[model samples]
Target: MRALPAALLLTAGGFTAAVAQQTAAPDTMVAKTISNYSAKYMDAECQLTKGHYKVSSGATYLSTAIERGSIPENRLRALASGRRVITEAIQQNGQDKNAAAWYYLGRIDLHLGDVAGADSAFKRAEALAPGCAQDIGKYRRVVYAPIANKAIDFTKANQNDSALVYYRRAAAWYPASPLAPYNLANIFATSKMDDSALVYYDATLKATMVDTAAATVKIRNQAGYNRAVLLTRKQRWPDAVAAFQQYLTWVPDDADAKKGLIQSLRAAGMADSASAMEKKLGVTAGNPMAPAAVTGATADYNAAVQAYNAKNFAAAAAAADKFLVVEPNNRDALYMRARSYVELKKGPEAAKAANALLAVDPMSETALSLLGAAYNLTRSSTQAVNTRLRLNALPFTISSVTAAPSGA
Candidate 1:
């Protein structure tokens, strides 16, 4: 019933530096230890929106409202540094339902890998300004900005050279942004540039997932999940097992991690570990990678798209995780999860998606591209090249960027 702040209102100027140098708590947290002594996280959120979600000066004054409660220094540190979040806020001018706040603040929570925190922010918006959801439905912007849109288009064009040109162009344009390299890393992996993709994926991880100080356990879960998937695809079963094990430690409920662990163990010839995990998750009843029931969870899907577009891969992954909680068989959720892994620099996770993606749509360019990326990043350059070449040889016009004939 309580609300969390909807967004981070990092000012345009000094705030960038504030964010760049933001310090975090150093506690070794296995999971969250939320206490009610802190201000209640209100579920109220605004529906009317203007700009992207985040905090504003008026909401800053609400510091007094929060002052009434005693929050853990660590929690306070998390909030101040954008790791923790408030799901709702009351403005000084008494203006309620600040929809944008939820969107952007969710971004912060997403970046910090706070799935619970991010969800709370969106719930607050739902509670505060329910009308904004209607607008979101009406004028839904394309998730990827113009530059990313071009990259996707170019990749479809199969103009590797020209695609590279545009991809590099976007990367330079958003020099510090993660999505450019994230997308490029996928391509490099597809093109059998596994070593190169790994470099880029590592960079993508740093840009999108890694955090120092008091970061949440979720980021580690995400990064570890991704790494495990990539490693498994590259046939590095031991490392994949270790990575999956690390992911399970953070997200014990991840069916995929459980399945991946089993697969990794089997691949490593550690059949016993694989069997133990299989028995533990009880996948004995059905396929481990079965799609989840995500139909009614449209809100979560929209939120995931926003996070993905904002380049908040961890948050998007978290959103996908929540959706999967409801709908395991949702291919969209699986695809998104794999993408989240790639963006978060978890090659193994991406590989999981890549492999499964082929199952759903073998001819999917994006799926092929992602699989190629995963293979390349994990040191299977030959496989990556093979995948890309197969994609290029498709009957349809392959080069989205270059219109010339195959003979050309």
Candidate 2:
């Protein structure tokens, strides 16, 4: 190789030195800039900038740091700074194809308690980078946990309305988790909101179908059982029978489930099947409406009637339930129990009692009326309409006559 001229060699050396300086200056500036921000904030920015600039990571790290720091003021500042950095990145790069920017934006929104914003950002991120789904799911659970925990606390305190709000938020945040929906179903069931309860129970079942975890299985089983009970209460006998059978498959040894199955079978007009199950369970009679000699439970019957008359509906229902154990076919006791349940706004129990009465006396106008009221309370519009039609078809009787001529 030929030796270079002296001036050319010196010029080449100076050019190389200048190029190195240019590269080193940017690195030094990046390091100093990164040090001024949190590691969490810089991580994400660096990733977005392909390690050329320092910026924090997703909301997860900053949130973790905030929690560890245990200072409310620090949390506020860190979250604000993180949000500003992510927002600026999105604005500069545009969210059109920047998954990291969108993902970090979602994290910041989640930390800021802007659930809807976080949801939108996550969706955008998922659309931009399908590979980020696992990370998105991980962060989604982070948002879900505290909301669900708060809902649980509210439920325990009997603050159902507040519990409902947080539970709904949690469910929306993590739609694949059965926990929030299961708890929501339970709350609706306890409140006697059967239709709403059924919706959430179905959600719980759907979410748990592919999850084989023991806790999830338990939730599915309970949701199935409660759904069946609600169906039976709504007088959806066929659906109730199927739901009960399905639940029994999951918990074959549960006596209450067997009993529910028997009741549903009888209601669905599968008397022979119900009788066989009752015999197998060593039960006296699975159908409360079965024709039988009236048994003596005079004291309990009178107590139930007295409680009902006094407007102590819960006590009245309890007393009537006790009396019916001995005299299940007693029309008076059934009527009192059904009426008391109506007063207590327990649509399902009232419907069950009304149905038993109807089975014993199909032409019972009072039983028809009570069933209609129960269907109304349960929001079973179709059943309520049918009950009203049946009631309207009955021949006018002296007892049903409410008033004489106005002048008379």
Candidate 3:
């Protein structure tokens, strides 16, 4: 009869006989097996002379046999024995620097369902032998998908702590994928952990940059937007402005993003640019104010006056704009808003506000004076001269004000 395969011979009664013979002096048998396998397969002496198993291929075969249910109990025993042997070898001989040893250790840990252990072992193997990086990544990808799916399930169930643990592992396993870090950032954001959220959002963005998949574009855009919002909430106005601008480049017409950009710009003291954007977007200072009310109007007018007194010109103009939403023809509020813009040195905005006041009270000497000052600030000499003529044409009264203080 033809000779049987080595695997079949090992799985048959031969395996039992071998174990029975080794039982009397198990430690010596282990060392002998390591030396024999190392000399046959590796063409070198075993790194640990007292180890149980030095051949990675033998562990691989036993792991496969266990999976196939061929004397699974015996295969499990062999795997356990080999693991302890390798652990002892590493400890005794400082075989931690041995790449092959660590690689096989990772394989054993993976087969045994010790995922964290496998991950650590594989990382050490890759660090020791950079040539093993590709193989390490291939092995890691096997575990990454299942772990990432578990993280997703936990996230959906609102078990955030469990989700975080699995997601962190998944991210480490496959750092090239944006999904893990993106989900992590969302979870942190939901928990009101802005700082942590920002960190993960940055990670997601960095990964997506390298991925360049069409699906990841959406993730990239959202991460950028979320990072900007967090910066805004933290009052890091300059950084928020840059972040919002970057996001807007990806989603130029996003209304909410535009609003965020506007807020950030205003906070960063780019009031002129903010005002220009507001006009471009056809939005007033604050777009959806409360419905017109006498009490609301009174409160807004008072706020404008107080802000103007405090020299917070932007706030004063914003308050007046809100008041005008309620009383569009209110001369006092319009005049206050115009004066605030002038104080802010925003000539175009002052001109626009002065025109609104003029539209309500054409013959008001104060309005004409402000209009002239605004035109002069804008360097519109002809318009300033015409505005001065209009002011002079207005009948003089004791209450009539001379041209607005040469704010230009």
Candidate 4:
């Protein structure tokens, strides 16, 4: 017969018998159902000594070694011996074996690359006594981190289905890992699966909020911004305004967000409210109603605006297009084109024009509102809902901001 590797032999039949004989279950060890196991067994006070079957302590020792690095040859053998004893004790003791045993069993299975078995065992442990393990955090690091990373990589490659599986698994295994929801939300958003994306985005925001670490804070901040933008695009004007306001709390001077807030307010049909916000933001004589215009395109801008106000959408769009040809950066012309598209119920065209306007002056409330309306008119209900929810969560108020210079 050929020699077998230690790992193989331990998992096979030979060592199991030897170890079972040495650590037989004690007569005093009363059997109890998994769901009714003694708390004493789960606590650290129950140390493993000679002739005692303490599964969790052994699991802790083995798992700690595995997390530190490769299990030494001696330690590997010891763990194998411990596993055999635990198996025998569970079989003989029946319902008497503590649920912590299953938790430990899961840890061992994970070490052996039997993820399915490990998951089953963990579930069993939880079924018997929910949250039986005293040191669950270590198990999460040993198991879930690699899985979450794989999900992230899959997302990066646009392998969304595979990423979804791993991300969900990672979340199942370690619910507190913000990366899981964040990555899942990102993939859904990219796929235009707005419903799922919004769910995960909300989850990510909630998880990140409780963490005060620098990295977590940064993630939370970005989550707030992204959520608010999504809300704005959904045309839930009131919600979008609220979200943008929330975002401003963290990033008070973000011009784009401020513009977004203003647009949301106006879209909500709160013109007086919008005007009040502009004042609080210190938009005064210096900062005119319109963004700075190219000197030569002033006449074209005035003509476009006049046509728009007159409800001559087609004529307004034409004039704006002509102005854009001369001064592509003219904010007023871009706004007119976008407004005309909206009035004409041309969702795609409106979105295009609004996007162009945003590119030139990203902090224009009017443009943000227009873009959001475009999403709604396009029949993207999920997208619209997500946008509204995200934007409504942001901070919109600001203090002590000088208006644009009195006259360009």
Clashes of each: 58, 11, 0, 29
lDDT of 1 by residue, 281-388 (tens): 544423333323433455576667677767788998888778666656445666777777887777777887778655543435677778888877777878888988
lDDT of 3 by residue, 51-131 (tens): 234544435543443454346466556666656655554555556556666677666655555555556666766676777
Worst 10-residue stretch by lDDT in candidate 2?
Answer: 398-407
How do the residues 237-326 of candidate 2 rate in per-residue lDDT, one tens digit apiece?
A: 889989988887887655556767888888889988988887665555745333233234545666777787778989888988997786
Q: How do all models score by TM-score? A: 0.33, 0.52, 0.54, 0.49
lDDT of 2 at 271: 88
Considering every candidate listed, which one attains the maximal TM-score? 3
Model 2 TM-score (2 dp) = 0.52
- Candidate 1: how large is its RMSD? 21.8
TM-score-best of 2 and 4: 2
Candidate 3 lands at a TM-score of 0.54
Kindly give the stretch of ten consecutive residues in candidate 1 with the minimal lDDT sum: 398-407
The parts of candidate 3 lying over 4 Å away from their true place are 1-71, 284-408
Candidates 3 and 4 compared by lDDT, better number: 3
- Model 3 has an lDDT value of 0.65
